[model samples]
Target: MSDVTANEVTIRQYRPEDVKYLMEYAEENEWDLSMYDHLAYTRIDPNYLIVAADKDDVPVGFCGVSQNAPDTIYFGNFIVRKDLRKRGIGRLLWKAMLEKAGDQNIVLDGGPEMADWYITHGFPYQAYKVQFYAVKVNDEMKQNIMFKYDTKTLMESMWPDLMKYDSQVYTNFDRTRLLRAWFTGDDVRVAVAMEAGKIVGYGSIHRKPNGEYGLRNIFGDNEDVIEALLHNMLSVLPEGTVVHFMMPEDKPLPKYIQHSMKVEETAVRMFNKVKIETNNEKIWFATAHTV
Candidate 1:
């Protein structure tokens, strides 16, 4: 292992054949990642991810780039082989990411321990830390549930205003295209909460490659709207299904969600060039991939 120098690896565009090897490295690190979840991103931009290949052209590390807005780029899916640390492969991937991102604002979530490195590199502002939690759904928690608002699924008629609401909350970008892509798959479900004939909140959920479901973009104006959107989204899924979601470190989960959830991971949210404004108090985060 000591003889394996960082020079032995070279950065290159990701290939279809490299998916299996990349997934293996990700799984070995216990990452909740799947090609199915990232498909929306790659479909929109094929060059969204890059890999560091060994001397033999075998991918040993990876990084991903996604422009959530005209001025914002999010870097994620960072990994080097579990046994291949300290050889500068990750730095190579980082340099490549910087090159791709150019002068746009760079936003990313990374390990707390590595904050200093990122700060020195470029990202120097802290927005907030976040927790990604995993929990399973069952009939037991469905009791005493009340829907405070009427929930509507995504439709052709809802496009204009839906984008407006999402843009208002997310603030950095208009996710019309991204949201459309995320809400399209057969297994995906989307809900918009309404009260007094007005939009209050919205959410979405879908099955991941690992059989667990990803609850995406649960944004609401208040706890009531959040609760309704969450319950309606969950009610459609079968029992015994595991779901992954995110929350800011300062905010607790709504009082009514009656499941024992575990924090799957933690990372500090950071930005360079600018700290984008979001309605942080009102939104339950989804994936940092686009946020």
Candidate 2:
């Protein structure tokens, strides 16, 4: 243990060069995080993720607030060097994180072991543990679920109605920026379903490391629309892509999807403010990071 004191470190915004250290930090700790998460978080909100630097200016610890929408952020990538745990380093990082999120509704997924700590920090309501599930996609798997609605490939021009439709569900936050930032990158693809030219639901499929694919937030007006979005996303990806996603354990998966899906992970989703109102029925699957 370095026993590095808080005063010996400087806290500042994350820099591109610090990725190597952060990646190592996450790997050493056996966290579920990946390098893609670090880069994406920074790309989404450049100034939100703050890092602790030693006297040599090397990053020692870091935390990020994924700006989901105005006054709504997903708190993640929070970690400190194992040897440098305690000694006020985490406190400094937390202080900086809090400063970056003044009065914003903070959401995060953590293990039960950290529940008390989160509650101590002002998050009292515990809704349910996030459930992570994965389904393997192939030509046969595609036939299990029928596409009952029409879905369109997400494009820059449809952002306006997309925002309006998504806002109806995530009423607490204006998630236009969050949506724009998330559904990007060459390997990322999003599918949207509309009814009468109005947005109904949307979902995203993105390539994850190790040849697997991930399902981003899968929302819709009904089960049919949600299933259509999922079907469309899966259809575009190559055969045998393992798709993983998360949702509140209590949320029911479509019957067809439930037949083949398997739970892979679970974690507690917490919020510092009042619980956000969400229609779980409309959300077929949630972004995997909740785990």
Candidate 3:
């Protein structure tokens, strides 16, 4: 680990007082603050988030380690100022936060530019490359697919069914608390896919402050379940709205969705030391900065 304390840079646990600076960093970089807030609120422990500052006490970068389950640790929001990157600040920050994870497997979805850096440090490929897709909501696009299953607004009573599908779709991690918060939180709408009188899949749609519609979380066992959930979610959005979704590049869903949507960007999921088996084809959208 780099000795940040011995140099001009210092790494320390994040504090409530750091919110303003962190928010500014997030906004300046065009990143949504919601993801950071979500991680902060749902983190396994308070000390998992670490911030690095220059000798003058100005925040330079920050990173977080989250225990999605007791054994699965997720690395997220590792950002350094554009002017400060390539100077070892990010490395120092991550090294400090990573210690909190101990021996747990580390996982993250990062841009291609950082893939080599992460691989050099220990994280190797665990899944196919993922891409973000976007589209302007309209009548013609919404008519692209016919739902083979039915979907309804998610209910607290369906938590068990949601958990069942989540366990199958998301693999080993138990993200119940995080999923619940995201699904029921203000300005968010969740739909549950149903077939044969049981929940087969679920998805959450949230309108971002920037007027974009985020297909926040979508998971299912097959195309029919995903198509049903997506149809219900998209039906709620108004025309001309920009909708966003993420899927693995190797998955057929992207090709199906790209019939109306445009490719926005891509990222790769990497893991350190251990690869957590995940069903990449079963996911349509995932947490941008988490497993």
- lDDT (tens digit, per residue) of candidate 3 on 131-226: 777767677546656567878998878898888888786677777865754565566788888889888778888766567777766888687787
Best by TM-score: 1
Which has the better TM-score: candidate 2, or candidate 3?
3
The lDDT for every candidate, in the order shown, is 0.78, 0.75, 0.71
**What does candidate 2's lDDT look like per residue over 1-291, in tens digits?**
455778899998878888888878887874545655655666677776788999888888988877776567788888899998877888888888788788988888777788999999888876557677777776754665545567889888998988787777777656666666766678678788977777888888777677877777788877778667777777656677777777667777865466456555577878898787665666667663531
Going through the candidates in the order shown, the clash numbers are 0, 0, 0
The TM-score ranking, best first, is 1, 3, 2
- Per-residue alpha-carbon lDDT of candidate 1 for residues 88-205, written as tens digits (9 for 90 to 100): 9998998999999999988898878889998998789987776778778888556657677888887779878788788778686677766766677687788898888778888888
TM-score of candidate 2 against the unseen true structure: 0.82
**TM-score of each candidate structure, all chains considered together:** 0.92, 0.82, 0.84
